[model samples]
Target: MKKLIPISIAILFIAVIILFVMQCNVSKECAAPAGKAETPAIRADGTDLTIAYINTDTLLLNYQLSRDLNEELLKKQEDARTNLNQEARAFESEMQEFQRKLENNGFLSRDRAEREQQRLINREQELKDLNAKLSNELMVRQQEISSQLLDSITIYLKEMNLDKDYDLILSTTVGGTILHAKDGLNITGEVLDALNNRYKKKK
Candidate 1:
């Protein structure tokens, strides 16, 4: 089976991460200078604008829900492939039998031979349709799983932020624009740990 997960799904998580981070910053007016102080950036309403970033690629890899979903999807794809292969083998056998009948004039009449040919064509079409349908269904399910994982991350961020009082929690990819930050600003490990812990409780 081809890669069950799409890179677009990772991009989708990036988009969702950005949106949630924006929500955290939306109420704040502006940012403070880098390395200004340990204190968070202050909002016009006297709120702190503590900002941190997570490595999204790392998060996706370590995130328990994502791992679980990936395994499940892989299994589903393998099963689908096995079933399709079986169907293909059966179709090939029938096709060979049809060819043999044609060559030996086993059909009682020309009309019967043509009818068998049409039937084989129709069966082949059905198998093709089935394969396409199964593939499409799996794709849809993968998308749903991706969205669900994003929702899980978003919810966990909200809960964690409530206690941590962060104003913005950004997610960065390996080669994203966020080039440098102090070790203190990287919250990926903490977030991944929390996410896994929460997932464990749920399971």
Candidate 2:
């Protein structure tokens, strides 16, 4: 089975959030610093613009929901592959039988031989169509799982931010746009813990 691409939810969510923040700042007539600063950037409101980051790679790997969904997907892929393989083997066996019948002159007439040949061809096409359909279904299922995971994380983050403790929350992953950030700013562990606890309660 072909491996599904890892979800890059961090990159996507971060890009959108950054754009929204920029728009908000522009509306408030807040001027961003011309250069990078060692400390957290101050917002237009004069309070410390608290920024925290979540390492999405870590979060996904540790989050139970993600792991369960991933495992389920893998199992589904395996089952699809197994079924396809079995059908393919059956088709191959039929082809071999047809070849044997042709060699042995077992067909009563040319028309019958042609009909069997056409039948085999049709079966082959059916197998190809089945393979394509299964692949597409698996891809769709993977996308749906990814969307669910993203929605869960987004909802949790929205709730977590109700207190307005962090002015900006960013997401980072390995080899992501955020190359470096302070240890204090990395809230991956805290967020992961809370998310897992919430998920546990739900189950």
Question: In terms of lDDT, which candidate is strongest?
Answer: 1
| Cα displacement (Å) at residue 185, model 1 | 1.3
Global lDDT of model 1: 0.75
Worst 10 residues of 1 by lDDT: 1-10
Stretches of model 2 off by over 4 angstroms after superposition: 1-42, 45-48
Pairs clashing within candidate 1? none
Q: Which stretches of candidate 1 lie over 4 Å from their true place?
A: 1-19, 22-49
Clashes of each: 0, 0
Please give, for residues 7-107, the per-residue lDDT of candidate 2 as tens digits: 32322332222211322243453344545462347655444566778778788888899878878877777788888889888999999999999999999
RMSD of 1: 4.9
lDDT of 1 by residue, 38-145 (tens): 334565455666678888888888787887787877777778777888888898999999999999989999999999899989998888887887788778777788
lDDT of each candidate versus the true structure: 0.75, 0.72
